[model samples]
Target: MMDEPNPPVWPDSVIIVHDTEDADTMKQKLEPTQDSWNAEHNTFTCDYHFSDRRYAVLFTPGIYRNVDLEVGYYVQVAGLGVTPNHVQFKGDGKGPHVPSLNRHIHKNSGTCLDTFWRSGENFSCANDMVWAVSQASPLRRVHCQKDLYLHDKDAYASGGHIANAVVDGHTHFGGQQQYLSRNVHFGKGASGGAWSMVYVGCGDNAPPNSATNTTITKTRVRVEKPYIAVYDDDKTKFQLRIPLVNDGTTDNLPQVTGDNEESRDFRHVKVATASESTRAIQKALDEGKDVVLTPGIYYLDQSLDVHKDNQVVLGLGLATLVSPVGSPCIRVAPGTAGVRIAGVMLEAPAVDPAKRKSTESHWSLLEYGCEGQTQADDPKNPGALFDIFCRVGGGGDADKRHWINIDSMVRIHSSHVIGDNLWLWRADHAELNPGESPNCPNVSPVFYQTEKDEYNVDTGIVVTGDNVTIYGLAVEHTSKHQTIWKGENGAVYFYQCEFPYDVDTDFGKAGYRGYFIGNSVKAHSLNSPGIYSNFRNATVQVETAIQHPDSPEIEVVNPFTVHLDNNGIIASVINGRGPAAQKQGVPSRV
Candidate 1:
């Protein structure tokens, strides 16, 4: 068996700097990223730093006792999953909703509990995490340059106050501090965690209190940094290389339509009998015609393989291409480059929430007779051995049904785009599959080895386009899901989008990103590395966590470097772990 990853070990190191004197002004808050949803526990707070303007990592209850603890504690873990402390909501489709997890008020909310990381001492954060406005309580009164705000999910995320927020007219945090994207939210066990290679920037064009305008000025800044590297030998965590972006660029982006819409015949197309739009679209492709979709639902499922060059499939002005519920929805495999898939509802089916297990409640096992390996050697979270429970033949169908095997959904974890937009509705398979896709039941944690030559009905969407722009979309409820966007595809711009019930954390092992880049189970950039481009002004919500096969365990596997403003939650970056030890495993540095 592969050895578990060792925790990082380093003399507690701290970086300190101080800068003062700046003028700043604030702009009107235009929109909210998130609206209404279920409520959860776990208190999360962020502190900004200004010395060098770096974002400090998140601090959890695990590290609360050691609040003044220094940074740079070496850690080795067996199955550690990462997450954004909290995120803002930004779902499009015209509406207002409430924030989940009684955030603004802690009166009724109990103590917070996170199952992922175990903290020994307080690791400090003077700068990394970003702050956001709770929907119920939008107005925040800041009195200091670097102040503290509270975001309690149970309180509708309302009520904003600046606890210690005034130093100068210009209000901002230090560079070394950590921040979270305002457009995402975390599940129950995920508030106050730390991650690496993520980016956090101050509000665009916002100035310090000193300045009259809150726009980007002379000293306005954000930060991006990497954490520990996962070692393959005995899973030793190590350091990684950080490539600097050269600033001497001058290449104009290629137009989406390529100088002229390349007239090419569309191949392998089908349409709904109820709508002639499909036939019209098919006709355009047959004659190398460019098909533009009006805002309408064209119900049809056909394998979309564009072998010809210069294919432009534009769904203009709220144009949505809905995925078929029962059958495999849409299959897109672009043979050439510059394949555009914009403004469409790409999704599978969702099992009725009422029919399924309570999303707010964790699965309980009373079958004490069964014995097996477990995430908690402690009895706080008890289950039959098989229920912590092991099942013959990999948990089989029983384990995966409720879980919605993320087999095929929308997978865009492949390319990069400057402008990326997606709107979707998610549904589950005829049956639920709990341990199927989330990596919870995965023993070794490997990608699906199934050959594409053999058609799998559930495959979703995979993307790798750059300079992508997305706007006005609502995506939710999928099973055996794939992804909205998948790999190394960089520079995405999303406007008003959502991810409600479109996920599973599974074992917290196999990576499940609503918007993730493909970085198999290898978390090393030096020996084996993963890559990402960038995303700006995006929104995500309700991507709940599932049973991780390596849960309660910790591992420092290869982590995907997600550098963004507002993104990702529930599950953060996960390290590697082993079957032998997954319960309450603390991370130790090598």
Candidate 2:
């Protein structure tokens, strides 16, 4: 028999709470002050007087009745149980029972939960679950018996990541950039009511169809209702991969159809070493078989080209492709359809220690489509990427140095490309050195900061093709425009972006925007969005959230700005505030 995995050790920074305590005692322990009082003795409230500390609250198993809690930034609430349902938070109320009433609402605006559950009546709207979270804080391993609401009307909520969850009732993701993965159920009924899973924008008057850019992957529906619905205006902005299928049972781990077919469909080619990777992959492509890359770092002196149609390049755990200093990593030829690249990390070349301030020489790490391909609009055939992670720097001894100084991380020149769970990061958080002298020798803490005349990456994604769809696009800390969409009819669902944090005098002082839509573009869409910019030292500010002159139907739920110091300290924050739509010549909306 196999041994059960040991429970995760709670960090020392976590606060341990138990259900054995009375309501009053528990409230005091959570708030630690009377400045934010629990007026009804049921809701634990924390006001502005509360300290801004990153905290994790671990709850022992038990039911705490009639409890509603409020928290602020960088707080994580988790249940200490073998499974998510082992711990319960139940309340007495159902829908419309106002002030001092029956509903249990965890009115957390800027917080996170590892697992949040409530038990009472499964069908009652009164048993609603609500929270407002950001990208830095994600909800993991959560199972809620009640309907989940991202944000109430009053709070500005940006969407975060949700994984391995089960919701018995409807889930309303009304924030920006919400990504759902490996979820069991969402919405219970087929009717167009509160039981239907809906995504909407945050404006008070925004219609249910105002929600944009929400992505769902590897999720199933429990009931026979509309599995997923977007706002009338947001049809193209939502990307659905592995559609929510019903397996005719309540099994959380149901045997999904085609679950094992991916392995059989592709001809698995295992490359033993980095030296043989490029040649092996090319041979597989030539043989009209899909290539499977096992776990290892594959160094490429030249670009690995995919020319055939319906070719899939799959990778196992931690399989990475590293590019040389001045070469393209991977290229997809034009007119190629249904090409998939999944489960891999792409790394740009490491920065040379001797030329710390020199410019990088690559054009792009990954380029899709040939330069002169006919830009035809074809939805029937497309290129796709699943669970792809890309990094530009911070892979070696010294942290924060720009490894790949390219014009774009991903440049798409072809149409109808779909991306799921795409994360392009210019590493901001890492240890300078680990082992050697004290911690490490010759380590630089602020390598992300640009020196005079040093080369830097310009953008995360530059889309020149039409009808390109991305489910979860997260780009952080690029030098200039984070994402620039010039393509026609491009749809982006669930975009999570963060501006460079360690910008100082060494970094140049201007022209950085979270997203820049090209002026010539006519139709582009984005939904379920979160864009955060934290400026500490440099005067460079984003030109505008959206720069497209021909106003696209873009919906952003929460956009934030923070001012911090060079030492990574927050001085002030303007949360849930985005640029004016009218300034970009788009229709005025929040």
Candidate 3:
């Protein structure tokens, strides 16, 4: 909460501070710079991370007498026009309230996030912590969310869209920064200045999605700081304190099947509360029979580890096997080989106990997380395991939102294709301590070790062995991107596949990620740069920026900020940043 009083007017503001007064002089008198290290390249691999605590960033520091903001509340930049990148704003000029305008993409690549501050364009849609977003008009500016040069949340974005920003500070006299229909030029030494979007102005409104506004033909408008009285005096600024919902008892854990037989035929397989479902699955494997699951809710309180080779686990397409979103639904131990998984929609819940009520996504399936034995301490498990594919994650219980988790695979055919499915939750393995109260409820007691460690923390699907092949598979999420944990190496191959959402599918929480073994494959939905990597393409249609597909409620805004890293898809790298020649370069633009 900002307690500063609104002044008659805001004189000037600068996001980043510098010693020089004139930008042209600063440009002319500066030292030649090193190659610009695009943050996307690093951020893509850096895993999507969000600050638990609400935070705000200001390049230049300031004094405060009655500022009531907390650690999360940030200061602002002074000297509006000079330090940030140069931005071009367009306004309708008719009045304070104007019709909306059209939007366009930046053809050239220079309007990067970091450079935005220096560009004199305060359309900080990419990094919210640095500056603020506002809507300007003849009367005043409002602090509403709008697309701009830089995002206020400060995460890596796929395009140079400066529209998805909002005003964070006191509202003044600015509005959404509308861009020219034609590609405009943005010069260096002009990154963090304010700009305006047609018909849009500052307010507490949320950011809108990309749309067409054929009604207005304005050229541009410049952004300005709101009056000091615009400071928020009533609200509170706190970190995002929501925790993973936990189930007090591990009673919901699945019961393994390999240990029994009579239950295999589905006769006594069990129902919604039965614990023998796991035993039945195992019993079917022992008898070498395809275990047919009745189209009802089957409960196997713990993870259902498929240990039998050449086993088939079948489920009705409409039937659902609900698990707490983000919780491991089906797990394959390193001991299981020659596995064929398919036709089931598995989703973890935000609250484990709220199984039926939780609509979060699941981490679906994978061959295993051995990384073909290269990253695994046991060489026998190295890419040597034989695992197949499936038409899983597409089949949901009552809702279309589904999730699945798989590790390394031996040979994945279209059978394990993961076909078509709509997943809304994330495979987020994030959680609070076990001793603490459940972040949400019914969430698992398993602690999330996703802190870029050596432990096996892969969430979506981790495969670490050899001979991994993915053919004609489409993976995606409207809520968030999923991670495919590819450990130390890649015997991994993708053929005619699509990876579109590079901005959301990954959360580079780990150090290792081998996207491919065979260059013949294609991934279109590359979440953000590297992702937190979902997809688009020949086979799959993708939507949304970085987010948790299994998280239930889809974030409908223009990606305020996204967090990635499916520790599952990315495995451990034997060599940091790849071996030789593959040094650190953009794999494909992400």
Candidate 4:
């Protein structure tokens, strides 16, 4: 038997709070006054759009009454309980409404549009909850007893995702351009979707099947990210919760403690703080430690290499990794097995002009294993990437830079890997002005400089691994193909993509494909994939939304493409097969 390891001594930034005598007291403990709270909670409310600080606020298993938890930028609020029901926010008639959890309302706009990089998981709200967020933010394993509103006001939201939760009331998607809900139970059902809405393996009042509102009755397999939870009986002991594989089932509870080895083995766990350097982090990984990154941005001077099996690198509060010199931030060594990376953002920041060659561009931000290093399939312990996001620009000084150089966001070369809730994006615009627009002007906007300027990302994801599975994936605004699949027997549950909007006349007539499968691949499958285009700079047409070999083994179900605006047209769905969706308000399918 493995020796028992010591419990993790969490950093000061991670706040652990228990039930108090009153809700007001608990709220005060969670967030003190605005000035002091910025230091204690790391809650940078003033820097709502971008901040380097990260924080994780954990609630111990208990019932709290009439407390409205306002989650701020880069803050993660989670419940430390065996199940979500154990931590309840109830209405005790001390306030106007039931206990609610909401995003920090921006002081200028009073909207949730820019509420990004924050998350809430494993908790229950007695009544209404507002989570008006865009990309890179996720809500998982949450139970909402009443209404769930997606928007706080009239501001527009780009996209969002929700998975593994139960909602007894209606979910209102107001002003959200798109959304994805997987493995959820909706008792009262969903109300609105502006562009696209997809439901996979959901139960109770499922949306009527349509091309726009796509619904998949069953999912083949789903493995959730491992989470940290306090022991229900002994609060002092923290156990790692490994989720069970969901085979089209509503709920497949994980194995109880004493039966799961991981629950007891913390010997290899290493809690990492943002103050440490990349050398320190690499040293911990070299010692075969699973590093837990606290809330903060890591500036990697060198790649953090992971070369072992079952090694986990978990991040809290949207912990970001930035490559300042145009190099990869994280790289899994060749033939490495079962390296799990979750809740992290890989960002390609502006490279210094002196440090970068004029003709050079970085290949990838995060790489899973090396190309052509084949190994036997490890289905039981596949390399898993959950809630992993990649970005080219749109935060910090990234928007002010004239050039951004990243060829691809992620490259997966290890066979039999699973990716869930992966979003690879190249920002099309910069942050808006904070003022209510009564006097403030639009400050910075991204513009194409020259032909050699790597303004936007070339691609989002490049997959060379066989038997790779992805769920709830979104790739947007790439200069080339959004996703390139080269291996055999790959499957995608739900895919949302948007082609580059700035394909100008100087660019050739040959447009980019959204999902491109190599001709050498024998088998692949896609379910409910949507590609949209909005060529605002020039009138252009893409030859195909998806390009794949037409074979019986290669199955594509319910694939559609739509022209969002500006005379952008996609001629075909896959291999010159489906109708085109041009002219506003029209959708075409294959």
Find the candidate with the highest TM-score and give its number.
4
Query: Taking the tens digit of each residue's C-alpha lDDT, what string does model 3 give over 188-217?
Result: 112221221112221113122223111121
* lDDT against true structure, model 2: 0.49
List runs of model 4 lying over 4 Å from the truth.
Answer: 1-9, 21-25, 29-47, 92-114, 151-155, 232-236, 244-261, 264-267, 324-326, 357-362, 398-400, 432-455, 506-508
- In order of appearance, the predictions have TM-scores of 0.31, 0.56, 0.27, 0.85
lDDT for each residue of candidate 4 in 519-568, tens digit (9 for 90 to 100) = 89889988878888877767677778998877789988788887777765
For model 2, the superposed segments whose C-alpha errors exceed 4 Å read 1-184, 187-255, 259-275, 351-362, 375-377, 399-404, 434-455, 504-509, 551-589
In order of lDDT, best first, we have: 4, 2, 3, 1
For candidate 2, give the lDDT of residue 263.
27
* Residue range 30-85, candidate 1, lDDT tens digits: 11111122335343321110011111121111211111111111111111111111
Best by lDDT: 4
Clash pairs detected, candidate 4: none
Q: Which lDDT tens digits does candidate 2 get at residues 1-590?
A: 12212221223344556667887887766663112344565533323211222344456555666655544333435554434554567776222111111112434332222111111111112367654443333344456666676544334333344433556666555533344333334545111211112221111211234323222332222211100011123221111112222331344441222132222211133222344657766766666655545445678767878887766675532356886556567788888876777656677776555664456443777888866677434565567776566766653544434443656688889987777556777765433244523221122221223332223566888899987877557787777778988888777656667677656633323545677778787777665444555454454444344445545354333333332222322112112134332221122223
Note the Cα lDDT for every prediction shown: 0.23, 0.49, 0.24, 0.72
Off by over 4 Å in 3: 1-278, 286-288, 324-327, 333-335, 352-459, 473-590
